[model samples]
Target: MAPENSNTEEVVVGEEVGRVRLITLNRPRQLNVISSQVVSLVAGFLEKWEKDDDAHLIIIKAVGRAFSAGGDLKMFYAGKTDDSCLEVVYRMYWLCYHIHTYKKTAVALVNGIAMGGGAAMAVPLKFTVVTEKTIFAVPEATIGLHTDCSFSYILPRLPGHLGEYLALTGARLNGKEMIAIGLATHFVPSEKLDELEKRLVSLNSGDEVAIKAVIEEFSLEVQPDEESIVHKLSIINKCFGEESVEEIIKSFEAEASREGNAWIASVLKGLKRSSPTGLKITLRSIREGRKQTLSECLKKEFRLTMNQLRSVISGDVYEGIRALNIDKDNSPKWNPASLNEVSSEKVDRVFQPFEAELELNIPPEGDAYRWSGKYENSVYPTLKGKQ
Candidate 1:
């Protein structure tokens, strides 16, 4: 292991126990943020294990209250135009691509907060386990950043307008909700995770059935929290499912005025607090993502991310990073000031394809969606309106 400093061990640790190869994120103090060192270690381990004849399965876990908070925002805070930060972004995209097309049976035991880049790591795995302690979100838009790490490909596939709702509002979902939303394969209490890991490590076969059977032995049925926003499916679809952000907010306001619903009021507050430009671009990203392949989405997202970092049109990303992280002010002066100030032309520019050298490259096998439909029935049916 390469030691970067006296205080920090290698941020990622790889170990072989029986037939299973274990990859653990080791940075707990910083909430296991993805730094360049972590990326290098993960890439190395994945490469070595892929070629190892004895490795039958790959399991990823973390040692912290957060699986990972996201990419190291501090890196970008230095300057988005910094070449070093750009390199990390490119490496992160490749890592997401690798996880999607991994040859081994990939399982992730996700506990605690998994947002943005962390969710990217967990969501594409062949099997993902979560505990009640797990909380997941894609809050990029809230920080004036669009979602990346192949989320463009994954989010649009979620039921109804849930994906759009999440991208726009940065909603959080607990572990049970993760399974309900098809983001995780199994649910086990946090206390049982150790026992589950032992059982998983004992499995010697590559047969998916055997692997699933082992996982199921530790899995249990879990109900979402009583106050889950997902319970408001009709309202969510009615508002978020609309054609445009302005239309959706107007619908919410109209419904709130008629019915006096507190939830709608709260959602409106969140929308108003977020960066207008971020919301407009995020909506466009998820909508266009509906028709794009994973590879195509990643390529498109790469361009968008580069532009976001460069702060070409608006410096909202820089302003956001300052307010949320560096300054800790909780106040951002979003350029253009309001949603009405953003134009479709500006959003279109963010989605434009990148030049040849800047585009993300994926392996031939990574071009297709490889999901096995295991969690297809997870989402509950949407409420039908009265005739």
Candidate 2:
């Protein structure tokens, strides 16, 4: 292993078990939320570890109430400039890509909350060990937007209409629900999470085969029941298929009206509660994700978030944050108060990256959407609604 660097910000790293390298996020006060510095440190450590002969596997866990709360909002607030957000988004994109494609198996020991970008990073790992306290979500919908990264690629593939369901509501996935819904690979008592990690490290042959064997034999794997999928498939598939956000909302409302489906009704409530501008942009972003490669998606997200922060152009981001986070009003004074009031100009504005010279680390002349070796269902659904 490379000698420890005293100045490194990546907290801790060392071979925990034969070849399992442990990466514990260190910013406990912020619940280990990733910052610009953390990103650089993570990039350096991951790159070095990937090249080192001593590191065979990597396990990412945190030493706080959350695995990570996601990106540092403070950084965003400090970086009101267009370039500030760009650099931050670039760091996130590269860090996530490194994690997803790492040659060694990566495990996420999600002890508590993992939401938005945090969930994005954890979901792609080979094994996500969740404890009873673990909760996962993408609450960007509540903030008047959708998540970037590969959430588009991973969420819909989840059990039932869980992806879209969570997408619309900003609802959280509890540990039990996460496991039952095919999100968590293993579920254990919250108190035993550390012990379980130790056990995992102790095992010999800690390769994929060994990991799978332990996960199957010891952990209570709450596999998603296919019946749940079939039940919601009809509504989700059709609703998700709608061409626009307006159409999808109308479809959801109409479906609820006609059948009194509790799920659809609840989703409709959430739709009504969200920022119209955010919802429209989110729809566009999801559609963009279906076609773009990973890097392209993140680049698109970077531009989208920058557009979102255009305080001079609109009241969406500031008002949304103030209402949702500052005052906890939960009722934002949106620039365009109604969904019908949201215009094509507003929707289009959110995706327009300000700079002309911005570039992405697109793979050399190849399709960017190229997902590494497929697991099962990685494709974004074309026939949508809830499915």
Candidate 3:
């Protein structure tokens, strides 16, 4: 329970209803951004509910038009000069891991905009219910940060080279596209969400089958629209499959010249507008993610995040935030200015393992930490394994 206040300023609100434990992101004005406070509250609720015998299911939803816009970049910007911000990143990633390995079933009702940390919270759950109003993206690279919040593990597991494409380009995926790509488990119309919630609470059981059955009743068979970038899988696979960021841009450039595709041109422009160093680092992170376990990927991402924030290689993140958020200039002056100038050595240094004490300490996965989503089985195949 939150402390009583005249303002009722709770960023997150939680309650136990029947057999269901519901967590709501309450800070609509802030887009329910994942501040340190938000992380602490949500993590505490999840930990508490996991131990509650009366709690059979967990449902996470948010008020307003955005599920979460991402972590508080302004907060990050404020703490950029010191290690003060790293604690939040550490705790947030830990929360992400806990959700991934949670014992009981959890569902995210992402009925609005879900980006970065928002998408992080939803996608890893046992079931992610998206609606027509849902808009999802991992646009971190544009801000000179890598896609994170266990996305390193989740994204690489997406079908074809879709993971790389999304990570590199910060592409947006609609509800139908999310379902098609296995990022979402169900698509329920926005209007039925309330009824669906009521039905779920009535179940009062964590039985995956029972819960899934109820959800399926309202779930629609949705396909990505004809104009969805999801349909460009073949081209996405070919272009993003290249060994390097340079190669990827080159491939897109070649494709654009040959086909004169507006989409391809847009991709190329996005690449050109992003920090060269960010593109390189993000590309490597997603590639490494393919071979690493979820735990390993989180650790590596922790390192990358720390290094980026600390400006081990460059201060592109700061510049990016300044240009986009603070200054609203929409023009960032990347240190290396171009992809060719971002050396392999600098990128490697960013990924180097942190000191044992500095590393993220993730708990070992329990048997209950398994994924059974309809699309995940085919897209992810296995969650365990080093190779």
Candidate 4:
């Protein structure tokens, strides 16, 4: 049944075929952004399926070139000043929490672009399958937002300082890199996705072994490309492992001066151009995320995000949206524009606890390390190429 009081026609569609319940994001024209309406539609179906015994497993995909671009920026632009906007964000956070600790087996078919909130949806699923056409990123820093959607918990668990590097610079990864970084479970060609989906839906049991067996039948062995950033793990660790953002930038500059590494140069450019306050807070968030539980990370992120929207100390987020989406001018006038002008104290202010009324009411229940420890010691049969 379609959701009522909606202008769109079940833009978020959920249908059951045998034991599989497939949910698709249908807003292709909008790049399938996770708008509030989409959230309501998707969340409603998910809640319904949670009680349906016939829905043995769930598969989420999109009917476009992008699984989802991110949260709807236009909505943010319109409600930047309103407290009600946080209501949608809170809903998204809870949905993410539900996805992480979901009872049923979950699979995400990430065939195209999945950035920011989109990455959050797929990264926590029990099975994440990607295609050559897949592109993944969490470019929140570029828009003066720290990575949210429980990404803080996910990123720090990535190998070495790669998480810190990505959080600060807003780097991107292809499907191959995603597997290398353990973000994706399997890689199948775009052409083979339909066959894989058919096989997955045919499975009557939600048993992990049975599902893995079905997925393994269609998984491919693909190597990361020559120019992959993950290939520069050593350089990434050396620079991003620094104690402070200043030290990291200096390290990058030193490397750029000697080796003239184009990648390092580009990273430096991105960091320097991004909102200074954003870079500082993101670095802190990732560092703290390494120590915190999934629930803790989400709570902290909710506080920080609310702070950004509220603009208690700075309004870079609003400026970023205006520059990037509304004005289309591609220039954000960041307050305290330069990194030198942003102090550690200001960064600390964002992480301070919110009042009881403003705190994210997520239950303490979760499997914090559920996804982490599984892939660390054992390499998947198909992921041998990644080894």
Candidate 5:
């Protein structure tokens, strides 16, 4: 365990078990939230392991109820006024990109809450193991932030318009649901994770197929529950597939009016309550992500994040955090208070490219790794009246 500070708490612990390099997120009290220190430490470890010939496999897990909640919001809150936080964001995204294109086989054992930045860590790995305790979501929109951390690339590849629904609504998915959606590769019961880890270490070899077989031995055959939102794919595609956020909400409104579905009503309520500008920005990013490669998506997202942090268009992120975390009040007075007030030009401004020197320095496409998952084409039925 490497101590990050004078507090004697090792925020990230790394050790080798045979040929396996294990990384444990050790901040239980903080729900293993990713801080600048955490990103730097993990990135450093990955860089070292990538070169070490003895390291054949990498496994990332956490010590608390949360694998990782997300990026350190308090850090962002503290560095709200200056470009001081950009370095962390740059490094975090680069870390994510490195993991995405990692040379060695990698696995993420997610047994707890994995949201936002946490999801980024797990989803890009070659294999991800989840347990019943795993909870996943990309809920940046709810906090007046666009869905980021390379999700713009990942989400659009899910079957149908599920990505749009997730990005806009911040819907939470359990372990079973995650596997069903191809977001996770295996589902092991929480009780068997330790045994599975030991078995993995005993192999002492970096054969991908062998590693998968061992994981499968401990994994369970599970399915999404009857009440899971995944079952509502047709409705989701019908509603979220719309070109504009306003039109998407309108589709939901139409569905709610026609069927009076409690689910649709709840979705409508959630969308209405979220930041109008965030919804617009997130929707555009997800759509653009459909054609862009992983690197392109990250670059685009970096611009959006920087713009939001710089308050290029508005300071809704700060307001959102202040309302949710600082004041503990649910009410966030979003600028351009309604959807109609959020103009297309304003949305475009958020996605505008930064100058050459200020942009994220991602490695070229040929050097970066591409996801091997079967990316289903995101096609949706045309809305009745809208194009």
Candidate 6:
């Protein structure tokens, strides 16, 4: 049913799909950039739908030009440097945490671009679908920020050194590329997307084997295109696996000098422009993520995100928001005063826990982690063919 009232929330709509309940992202105008309002709407709906006996399966998708342009930068920009900023960030983190452990067969339809915080919405589902036009990326570094939410959990699980490359460089990919990297399960042509979705829903609508067979049909035939980024896996692992951010930068510099490659040149420039705090923390996050369990990584991310909020107002984050969103100025004066000055101590702080209690703002009523320790080993799966 179409919206009939002005009372619809900017972020969501709740409707029935046969016995399934579909929670759709509704902010088409903003490309569904998330805010606290959006977060609350999603969390609230999922929480409710999880309990609804009528909901046979959950279908999560977005309606927009781009599935989501990411967390609303304009809203984040408006609240920058204030306590409200931390509160907003906290709320978002809480939302992702809720969705991550949700027990149902939640699916994300990547009907368009999925990047940054928007990428957060797609990667945690039971299965994620991408249309031919779907473009995926994590361009957080370009705007002087780190990838937050539980992205750190999913990215490392992707096929190879691709996660590291994608995180640092903010390279975008189409649906076929996402499928290649194990980031997406199915790729349907945009015109055939609706029909494909109905078929998927049908297989899973009742019979388990039928569902598995349909999944196998999609999963069975993965095409190995000659032009895939698989060849660059060697370069990505070597550069991203260096000792520190400085070493990584040095590696990129060396690569650009030797190869004179356009990609390396862009990476070097992107590294220079990224938030120092974001870069250091990301390096640490990915490194720590290798050994960290899903629960540990989520807790660690919360710990890190909380600290990033309270350390100081007008901190590196401020300069990040200012340069990227406020002034429209690509130039940001990253503190520690200098690249050399951004010490190990400063980097350490991002990993350190915040003061006082470790209270999560979102109530832990039905968190999937609260139920079982099944997935709770300290170490996660490692990337194959990459050290």
Superposed model 2: Cα runs more than 4 Å off: 1-18, 81-83, 156-162, 180-182, 204-206, 223-233, 258-260, 263-266, 311-315, 352-356, 362-387
Q: How far is candidate 1 from the true structure (C-alpha RMSD, Å)?
A: 9.5
Compared with the true structure, all predictions reach lDDT values of 0.80, 0.65, 0.86, 0.82, 0.85, 0.66
Q: How far is candidate 3 from the true structure (C-alpha RMSD, Å)?
A: 7.2
Q: What's model 3's TM-score?
A: 0.92
Which residue runs does candidate 5 get wrong by more than 4 Å?
1-8, 365-387
Q: Name the lDDT value of residue 361 in candidate 1.
A: 57
Global fold similarity of model 4 (TM-score): 0.90
Candidate 5 — worst ten consecutive residues by lDDT sum?
372-381
For candidate 4, write residues 110-217 as lDDT tens digits. 999999998888989999999998999888888888888899999999999999988998898999999999999999888888888878777766788899888888
For residues 297-367, could you state the per-residue lDDT of candidate 3 as single tens digits? 88898889989998999999999999999999898999989888999998989999976645677765554
128-221: candidate 1 lDDT, tens digit per residue: 9999899899989888888778888898898888888888888889989989889999998888888787787777655689888988988999
| Segments in model 6 whose C-alpha atoms lie over 4 Å from true places | 1-9, 199-228, 311-314, 359-387
Off by over 4 Å in 3: 1-8, 365-387
TM-score per candidate, in order?
0.90, 0.80, 0.92, 0.90, 0.92, 0.83
Worst 10 residues of 6 by lDDT: 374-383
Residue ranges of candidate 1 with Cα displaced over 4 Å: 1-8, 258-260, 366-387
* lDDT of model 4, residue 38: 82
Model 3 lDDT at residue 196: 94
lDDT of 6 by residue, 136-241 (tens): 8887755556656777777777755566667776777877777777777776566665555566566446334554455445443445356455556777778877
